[model samples]
Target chain A: METQDLTIDDCWNRIGIWSRGTEKCPSLADVIHCRNCPVFAETGRRLLRTPPHEGYRREWTRILADEKETKPLNLTSVFVFRTGSEWLGLPAAMIREIVPMGPIHSLPNISSDSLRGLVNIHGRLHICVSIGSVLGIAKRTRNGEERDPAYSAPARLVVAVQENRPVAFPVTETRGIVHFTPEMVKELPVTVSGTKAAYTTGILQLGNLDIGLLKDKPLFKALTKDLK
Target chain B: MLLLLFEIGSDRYALDARQIVEVVPLVRLKLIPNTPDHIAGLMNYRGAAIPVIDLCRLLTAVPCENSFSTRIIIVKHQVENSGEVSLALMANNVTETVQTSLEALPPSGTIMAETLYGGVSGPDASELIQWFDVKKIIPEKDFLFPAGE
Candidate 1:
């Protein structure tokens, strides 16, 4: 049988509140008007008669499988720091702890400027080195003004194991951990500053920052060479 | 045959594309002490250490300036009875590969030693390209291949 032609007014009046502002409530006057309404019941019956859409089912199944199969990108956690106006990334695993800055007593008659000297942290002495000096990165203020290397504040000491010995690098600033995929890191270009290029494994392009990923082994070897 | 076209300083040169194994992005090189200036350094390619030669420094006195188009061209060099060794050639601004006949190349008056095999003005209105002899760059007589050691 054919379903009744449902008028806009008939549907509107059946919902009681919609009829309140109108001049005439066509279907509202009768108490059993909507309960026995042929249009409303026929509409529900017709919806039940229709078959489910094939495209919709396929889309939903594919979406659910994708959701189940997809996993987050494999990322490596690196601790970022600023030294000599340049931002560098060090693998988090290499860092022992982010200890508060300590007074490094300079050794007399030592030639290397990068060697900041030994610092006592919690009854233990660790050799502190200026990474900025070693990498030949010029020390500058946040305003990019030239900062006297000797008077620069020792913000944090990044203690790392180099050749089984603990070596701490005094950094100007420490910007916690950042994650990056392997694809994000590109090999260090030959054109980079000679000192910086030696220690840098590759470069990662972060927003408004070029993070030079440092190689621990070479850096440590360079820093802690036997004094001849 | 296909020829790999590249620029070293201002001069354009072409190498047999078949000899080229791959083109890698220029990366930082580990300096080998007491080696020649033309020997750029050792680079890790596919976990194997290969010697890289700066073509500009070798061919011309000028050092190759690193640019966006600079590439490390890995080439296969055959040694006398020792087999083939993969060596990376530092090329500045490697442009593209073009089809050129060796017969079409005419003898030029340029008197540079064994390096230049033949010179050709492009079949079209393109720039002049000199055929670069790879064997001359790393001669088996002079170059001692560190056979996979």
Candidate 2:
């Protein structure tokens, strides 16, 4: 039978009969079940045959092309992460690496709230900052019990750039990189929380939550502020 | 003239539909700090950035909430010196568009010509509509940019 003649319903019916056996066979005799039925087996084989219908392929290609065209261009890769209950999108190009939260040696006499100290990764020391303090988001402590970063389950280091210098900050969780189109961007309202309004370039509507797009300038400035 | 009616708290207001470009869902607007409280900041309309104002805050001192009926009414606002520019007016509980004429609207009787444009009987005869004076919403200097810069 031609692939064009086979519909999705027919394939589903074949699958249903194969699983239900002779008693459930609608078209074939009860005794001559799906096992012996040439129609059921042939239909299944025909469905599996390579070189699918040209019309179907063209329809799918057209649909995908329309989707891409409508989504707008300038495909930006972003590393999405969570810190202090806020979801932030950082451009992947600006991020050096996402490393496990390692031993950060606290610097003495450092007065900045965000700038914690330094962490030695692969023999090189990187400046570590607390993203919560930089963004003004209160850290969630259980019953005033401070969870150690070294042993925390969601702690990870985000090595990012600030004024041409490398700055690493801690995040609650890393959601990995997601490719976003210009269409996904919504203007960040001036009425947004006072904490993230300064640096958030735009808002990306991802699912039900708005992911604040953090640019290199603000993120770096916040991380490095008062340290100089 | 066709009028776009919307509500802010308990009051119903209208803007000439001819000046309205489009009505859109209230989306997050990028805040411009140091600007007046009325200036809600910038919003991405089409591909360009346009200033948005909180209509409720400007007129009634009520901050517009993010609700199901909240919307941004894009309209052409004519500034004193500068030519007409597109601006988004954020308002809450947009009701519907109704056709009415300026002559049909009764004078609001308020002597404040700068703010109160006019008044009209709403679609539902029970409600009184206060026409919004778009021109007086923001002064030229305080429109988009802050007081000095």
Candidate 3:
């Protein structure tokens, strides 16, 4: 057969048939006509060859597809926390640890919006970020409508590793963890306006619920430099 | 180009429109000790500590008087060798953004600068626009200078 007439599909078929012969598998020349094959130069790049059996080929295809799909999931882990109305996720790799919001020593004579207060966590001073303040959402007022008995809860801190350092994020409440598959994530639309989106990685669609996953690395780094 | 036009007291000024990320209302800011008077402090902007500069104070030596119109224009200025430097400017009010051309810029006589006063005229010859030389306003020395300097 003319080498020019052979396609990728034909190469795959030949490799499949050669593998079934069990003659220690056919040589590259016998199976793919390596001598005249224009694609032979690129053949060494792929580590795996096509298996002869129909079942094996299907299984290999599924394995490769799964490997591709699961790679991003390995880099990410879901961290569930509460903001205002709903639960959210921060990537687990990004989280440093959770701490309690204790006495925060405020620095005076500075911009009122700068929440660079100190929180003592296990003997180390961690910068406490006011979630509401940072997001430009109104802070829950003491005098405002009393917290709903059902939803009202004490504040908690979510310390995450941002820019390779630890920074604390103050949340109204802390939900637990929720793992995400690649299928569950979706990019936010540009029409969705807010400063919140800059740090958001994507919207994780969990059944009927939607949680925003935060990309806190850059944010934490920026905060760390500011604190310095 | 997209210009983030804003007012500093009654005077209107503009920085490079491309540098502006967004205009946000005054949020709670944490104060940094031992900084200059014009350095109003910093705000937690999407996890970054964006240094806030009182435009009125930085430009005219007038303290920033917060009002309903008060806003923060987050400007991202790139340093030559260094990386991006993000700072916030306190604007009395955010005005409209006008797409303009350099060719349309009015005569240079309409706007002049001294060592301190950096000025540029807008596309409309009638309107005078001042460039906020943020570097000059907040000198690198000041950032490294210890408190009370």
Per-candidate TM-scores read 0.41, 0.40, 0.37
Q: What DockQ number belongs to candidate 2?
A: 0.01
Give every prediction's interface RMSD.
Answer: 25.9, 19.1, 27.4
lDDT of each: 0.71, 0.70, 0.60
Residues A109-176 of candidate 3: C-alpha lDDT, one tens digit per residue: 64545365778889888777655445544455567575543234537777876656667766767767
Candidate 1 runs further than 4 Å off: A1-67, A139-151, A226-228, B1-149
Per-residue error for A91 in candidate 3, Å, reads 1.6
Q: How far does residue B46 in candidate 1 sit from its true spot (Å)?
A: 34
Relative to the unseen true structure, what is the C-alpha lDDT of residue A11 in candidate 1, on a scale of 0 to 100? 64
How far residue B114's Cα lies from its native spot in candidate 3, in Å, is: 86
lDDT string, candidate 3, B76-127, tens digits: 6665555666667786656456565543233233123222213334334566
lDDT of 2 at A200: 80
Error (Å) of candidate 3 at residue B147 is 74
| Winner by TM-score between candidate 3 and candidate 1 | 1
- The digit string of per-residue lDDT tens for model 2 on B36-140 reads 798887766666667788878877787886553667788886665666778778887675787764545444434423334345542247566677666654555
Say which docking band candidate 2 falls in.
incorrect
